[model samples]
Target chain A: MSESRLNVLKTYKLFVGGKFPRSESGRVYEVSDAKGNWLANAPLASRKDARDAVVAARKAFGGWSGATAYNRGQVLYRVAEMLEGRREQFVREVADAEGLSKSKAAAVVDSGIDRWVWYAGWTDKIGQIAGAANPVAGPYFNLSTTEPTGVVTVLAPQDSSFLGLISVLAPVIATGNTAVVVTSYEAPLPALSLAEVLATSDVPGGVVNVLSGKASEIAPHLAAHADVNAIDLTGADADLARELEVAAAENLKRVLRPAVTAEDWTAEPGTERLLAFLETKTVWHPIGV
Target chain B: MPQSIPQTVPAHGPDAAARLASMADVTASDAALRRFLHGLPGVDAVGLEGRAAMLGTRSIKTTAKAYAIDLAISMIDLTTLEGADTPGKVRALCAKGVSPDPTDRTTPRVAAICVYPDMVETAKAALAGSGVHVASVATAFPAGRAALPVKLADTADAVAAGADEIDMVIDRGAFLAGRYLSVFEEIKAVKQACAREDGSAAHLKVIFENGELSTYDNIRRASWLAMLAGADFIKTSTGKVAVNATPPGTLLMLEAVRDFRAATGVQVGVKPAGGIRTSKDAIKYLVMVNETLGEEWLTPEWFRFGASSLLNDLLMQRQKLSTGRYSGPDYVTVD
Candidate 1:
């Protein structure tokens, strides 16, 4: 073994069932930078891998959701801490993967970690802010708080791979939602590295499962899947967006249409984007007078 | 009992932007025509889910204009007629399009009576003295998945029943499969069917059912192909899909109708049907027509609504505006 290989930190694999496994197909598609330099081999996930990720997400949903919001907040902060340790590595991978300048990639990593920190603070509070007390005129005390919408299937954005992936997942799970997230078209490697960070970040198995494959192939399955409660299609073409909208209508699933735009990843799209995917399930204890 | 062969509509290359540009010029060439059309505006906005527009100056005043609306608005495909008690209901529905109110001012009338080939004669008798036309949806209605000869005969039957117009559905299955020219040829054959019996050939309006195609671009492409293949009108929806008569979709079709007139001098009408429930929706559609197709196409004879409940609201709103009080349910009676 060369000194470089020895000194080089390890790369991660696809996260399924809490363990990192090379794609079951044993197929890896190489992603390259603009200059054609090889970056890393990303998993060319098969349909089987997609299905496996779904199973893992379903399994982890109950316990993670049943936990107190305070406990969930600590786990989310752990992810931010682990991410802070890998800042330099992330900057290089994402910059090369996104073809952004080095400074932009570093900024994206910083924003991504910031995203984790921001949501970490929200785990215990989003429910209060989102859910409402209904003014039921004649009936009992009617209070509704936000609850996880359940196992959401997300098609992560193609450009802002790491930050976009983290932005979507952190908000979702901040309110206790589990996810089967599909990695982007060009930048799947950094997403897998984040999955490694997640595996060790004290988050329970299956809170978030990352799948790497063609958006066309994997996204349709998730959208049409009956078991999946909702789909966040934030990285698709117009045709794809319409198709998924139609398919989702078969069961009236909540659908988030893909944004047909490019932008700086770190910029805030505002709190609505975070508030949108969560269904506040407000619970209140009556005080006896 | 089947008289002809099964038919197919050949799909062709769809260049929506180019087609829209060409369809824009179908009305008149000179600057005078543009000035005249532009100067006249619609009476109200079309709040139809897809507030749509059409082509042709004198859109409201021509004998030719009525001919187009009779052909365009009076189509009811079997997709609507599949209800177990359809033929009679379809007849009533077709007649409703042409029915006018005594108190209406600047209120345009629908041109033709539309129905299934099975009920074309029924519509003919119901609208005999009304000067309204009889039209039928042939070639399998909403799906448009049959063979050529069968659709041709279906068109022939409706015409034989005194149909003044024949509207057919393109094989969306074929279009999605990249069979564009085939869809074009199928439309041509149906147009031919309109002329098959004795010397009486109905005007042909091909229903692209824009909802199925989805994008404004695809809608434009389909509208162009239908017009090029001799469609008298390109319609918005079958009232079947969730997304229908979107304002954006109508804006695109209006542009196409305008350009088609410039290219072919074949002025076309626009019909946005399905889910047009309120008076506010009707106004939005009128606005779209005024802005896109100009003043002439605003007449009932040139522009029509394949609507079930829109007429009542249009009347009610007109009544409210004319009289300070709200009109009662009996204000506009339906037979």
Candidate 2:
């Protein structure tokens, strides 16, 4: 029986609108370990797939952004809890994808879980830190508060796939901004597995869509998408980043350029990522009734 | 034995026979209705979905898209159905229906303003001379579990209150239990109740609540049943279910309407209510209508979208088309 049994390999597919779907283009690329042994075939998402993700993210934005800060915080913390339960699975996948030692991969997976918790706490308090009341000389009371900048397109960091992907993803969604994330090209299994965690973590469908494909092929379409309000170029090469930034200007999309190719993923992410995808909305009301 | 004979409908136009054959003997008895509906046709889920997916790829851009956008706006039955609906809210909705895009006066008024039964008078008062009809959802609405007398009274109240169109839900319990004649008789009763004492009757749109029906074949049967029982329009869902109007479901209804026209020479409209919130989704429905039912159903008189938030999205898209810039929610009224 053991000799006759076959291994049931997992099929990696695109996560869009909170469901797993084979790429619309019906294309897949071989995802292998650092030693060049095939692990699985990741869906080669097309421009149409990217556009569909934008539509999903946009659809999810209203409900997510309108959710109470307390609710959003609880959902984000739940993601951390779910990630902790699957620590061993991610650690092994990370080790195989990045050719890291078991212990090192375990450390990376732990940090990813910790990062989620870190961003989770920010969900409730980010508004307080970002909003302000201005003293106007006139009889009008003015206040400025932060609002999510609609749908955002993110490029996950290439190296340290698990920790880096979480580092970029948790912040954008922490502030109620829906994200369409492009997973690491070389190491997509961990990201695809992460989508499963998100689905069960009380996160609404389409709030965090993950596509596994070449960032070079998918980023341009997202950047030029009129519906996409912002783009993160952390994983793109210099040429790709420059081209994407130009395309993003078509709809005046807020572009988050990478400061360095290999920033420390385990380092503390301040308000930079959170602030990048938030719009400051100011309201004025008359003081006298 | 008399029940075995096929029922014939008077030919109001030249092509009436084509429509009656499928509906013929359908209302004769339990067995005949079952056989007629079962024998109508079997829906290939994969093929039906494949066709819908293929039609979704047609790109209507530039002038054609602008034309479709306006035409779609006119076909909207701007709806607001909540447990907390108030007269104030109904008036506000009716006002929005009349002037969808306040920034541009050229925006066409919607086809109708849909509300609950009690708000029919309020909606009629607000939309008195706007040329926009007032549609009321009756027949115990959302769920049709009420007694037949109560359901008929509900329809009568809305019609008496000056509702121009009546949207009624069919009992899915009877439908699922294979009590096809009961469902058929219920629709006919409601159709009679829509008649006012003043020699005028409200147009009747039968709601299938297709989510509860849960199958393409059921949707097709429900469509034919409603049409044969005298439905002015066949609607997809009540917008209260987890799965409301979907592309494949709407496509199936469009096909039924098309076939109904080909068979009986009687033209019926199709409305896919619920969960349609974007201009793109609305345009896709329009495309389905244009492709399935052709140019005849393209007019507001033939097609209607039972949606609420879809109106604002259409307005925003219209603004983008004209101003060449994306408009935010702040620029539009929140109803």
Candidate 3:
């Protein structure tokens, strides 16, 4: 006969530059479950946190974008493998966050893992689908290639914590762009847990920085940051999205406007998100005799 | 502290000659020089490092940050010391020093432009009448392994080419081997070479290469020795080594200069040359200078940052302040 012991709670922190650090401002807000039970204290990231995430993402853009597409695909596939191993923890987190039954949460978690694998397969093939050779009327070879548009700031959907988050985040990194993700403000636990899986799955540090805070608080800074090359406003409300879009115009950043309706996370995701953060570069070579 | 020493001994005068003669009495003998340097109070490594780390945590923001950025911009010794350096590069660096941010006309000019001895003439020519002094690194530079005569010739060449400042390196081997008088004598000889026909000498900045010294005590000793030998400024590193211009090392040197001024009315400048890149780091150093030596040493005449990349960072930060948005490397000119 043994006595019951107290449970050791995990301290959740923001993942930046592939390391877990507390918010630089030392602010945290309470995140509750769908039933209004306090789950944990998530870092209330400030503009400084967003600034630091942009720096990290910019620093990582060179190496991750320079790697062979096949290598990136392998790394993304490895993330899927790591996600498979942590399926139970994510299932529990999703169940509490989305107010679903264990079976339903497990189904969502499985779909998220499959979504990662689907993007992993797309990493190598995205270049061929997006780039081409030009038929110029000259004695020269003109070819167009795709390049990762430096650093991207991603706003993970507010309501769908796991599956929807993966559907938006995987395509950004799969195409070689490093991402600074602002996780779901109400339910950041699943996204933060996914950061752990990304860390162990052979993805390089700074490649995917996850900040758990309000999109409204952090998005405006990232949108206006000169170092950030693009912005995806999937998590922002209409007013916030419009404000971010206006701010993003300062740098002429590529902006992916938020969908008009709630996106279906379980449906097939097209190449729209994959091609959003890529820049096409064309080069000309003389045809020597 | 030792007895109050005399102020700077000018060249070619009866009173100045007497002052110079008296100054030589401190380094009159090798044993006396060693005794005087070792007699200075030993530095407490842990306490010094603790104070430096504490000073580094001060949060400077808004108006204070803006003022500090401008002050820091004016104190930079815009340097480009490489074997691959060209006249074109030196001219460009001088132009950049004249106006750090071409977009913002309000941005302050740097204190000087530092280049290799060969590029001094080009830099001086480009910076003619710009009010930004041209500084040349001489005395065999990062490695002061050459003979004393060769070192003096190097200093003389730069001074003859119209360099306003001569940044010379001390023989770290001699300093490490306990040959204090030889190193002191070498510095004095270089100071002699800095003299011009009109009795105005190019300001002599002595490099101690604190990374190779390996202890704070040695850095303190080196600071006193260089000041005693008439160094217009004492620099921390050549920026060639692995560890250059750390907070503790810079703080210790600043303390030495503050005490040196108290002991003797003669004030020497302090320059931490290497690895200080970001504006935040530049501000931390400014905070250290303001706290350690007060506002008097906060000017460009007493302190300088020997950097190349630091200018762009400061410019970027300057833009960030005015525009209310962060700036990037793409916004600043390529060095």
Candidate 4:
């Protein structure tokens, strides 16, 4: 049997608890490839899975965030390492997920891995680079640093699943923030495989969580979730992006709109990603010395 | 307690083209219109300056002395210390208290003294309580491409130094990229920062730099945007561009102010600055304002011209109009 046909025959399942398992809800739906070919019977993620994903995300946050910047960098870099080992699996998965050729898929996968390495190094250096000491009139010495904005819930882009997922996750996790990314609706298999790669890599569980389901069902929950400190709707459709932008305003959550460009997303300055995930914290300590 | 707009005709209509034509006729050969009306048995413009009619207050302030009579010095432009060159020339003008003409001392002084931001305190001290105000341009003046916080700080520092009016340039790149809301919000935020040290906002005039926008539609849109975004005034340009204040620009901006007042009842002043080097150019702007916005907006309270050499010509014109004998530089008062 051909590899794609053989792969499609395997019942698609949710990746959680460090393994791929049928959703506790036990419901399945046929998801099609971009060409309308039946790919697999993927799990129709339920609210329970979403709640469970949050649990996983919250549980993983402390250790992932508290780890030294160097350790987190090491973890992210390891994700690159594992993906390199399973390159063929990803090439087929990305091709089916985004309706691209195997060569194109391989190129995207390579770019995704490189993006992680680039962001991994940023975890340790972002603070010292963008912040400074303010010259206030009072006696307090004012110093500023950029901190990770906390749990960033991302709605990955509609197209370019693997690269979009990696681009969105890298910057968020690089700053010590945990993320729960909603997988592409029509083609989520590659996202599941990405989660598998992250699981085995040095990345601790919950630092990056992937959930596959209807974006309409998942976005409102993430946007309205008080536990999620920031949200990136770069993957959201027009209606969803607007709705998320409005919902995010309730708590004054820092929201980053989906990157809209026809050019190479990598060619743009990294500030668009870095600034979106960073929080400026100005500290004041009375100077008596 | 703001009242609804106090004018007839909807803000827009099917025949906007025709209405503009009628207004053109109403202002054309102004003398004939005035004459035909005065010839009426009961109608007259004579001795009718009462009724808040400040349009007659519209006059050009220039430096040239002696020409035709009735032409007045509406302002005395203080270009800069460099333009003034020697302190002797500046002290002479200051000592003269901005005399209207060498032949007479009865005419009032020009509206205000405009200069570089660094010289604001000096001008404020020099012109303090002398019925002349001090204005400064902020937000990096020409480009206005600074960070939001830094831009706000620059405005605050300028206002704290006694700049009664602040002229700022909007983020032109944002406007060009169709980021209207961002540009509007940025102007609003900067204007909010212009308040007194106690957090009370200062008077803000957003410079559209119409020369940069280069189109009537864009100028009109920018004017309305600035007005709606809480700008106290909408200025034409930064006075640095080649084609600063064209007749069409002033006309379009006046219509914007007119439409805004007809809708919101808030009267926003207009300043057609930049490249206004002659009294004639200055007077054309006044005429545009008088016709488009009507007479109520003609006072210095709602109108101004940012000119360096226009004031010299206006003064010389007023002297010639009064004395009928124009002379060299010695005939005019420096201060």
Q: Model 1, range A1-289, lDDT digits (tens) per residue?
A: 5755754535547888788887888987877775788776777877668767876877888988888999999999999999999999899888888788999889889989998899888889877777778776454567887777777888888877889888777877877878888888678888888888999889998888888878887777677655577788887778888887787775567887766676455677456556767775544555455
| CAPRI accuracy category, model 1 | incorrect
lDDT of 4 by residue, A162-259 (tens): 88777777888888888878888887888888887888887776777777888888777677555567888887887888997887776667998765
**Listed models, DockQ each:** 0.01, 0.08, 0.78, 0.00
Candidate order by lDDT, highest to lowest? 3, 2, 4, 1
Cα deviation in Å at residue B78, candidate 2?
Answer: 2.4
Write model 2 residue lDDT over A17-39, tens digit each, in one string. Answer: 99999999999999999999999
Candidate 1 positional error at A123, Å: 1.4
lDDT of each: 0.69, 0.89, 0.91, 0.70
Off by over 4 Å in 3: A1-3, B1-23
Best-matching candidate per DockQ: 3
In order, the candidates keep a fraction of the true contacts of 0.00, 0.00, 0.67, 0.00
Candidate 2 reference-contact recovery: 0.00
Residue A248, model 4: lDDT of: 75
lDDT score of model 3? 0.91
Q: lDDT tens string, model 3, A19-100? A: 9999999999998999999988988888888888888888888999999999999999999999999889999999999999
> Which should have the higher lDDT, number 2 or number 4?
2
Candidate 1, residue B245: lDDT: 71
Place model 3 in a CAPRI quality band.
Answer: medium
* TM value for model 3: 0.97
Instruction: Please say which candidate is ahead in lDDT: 1 or 2.
Output: 2
Q: For model 3 chain B, where is the 10-residue window of minimal lDDT?
A: B9-18
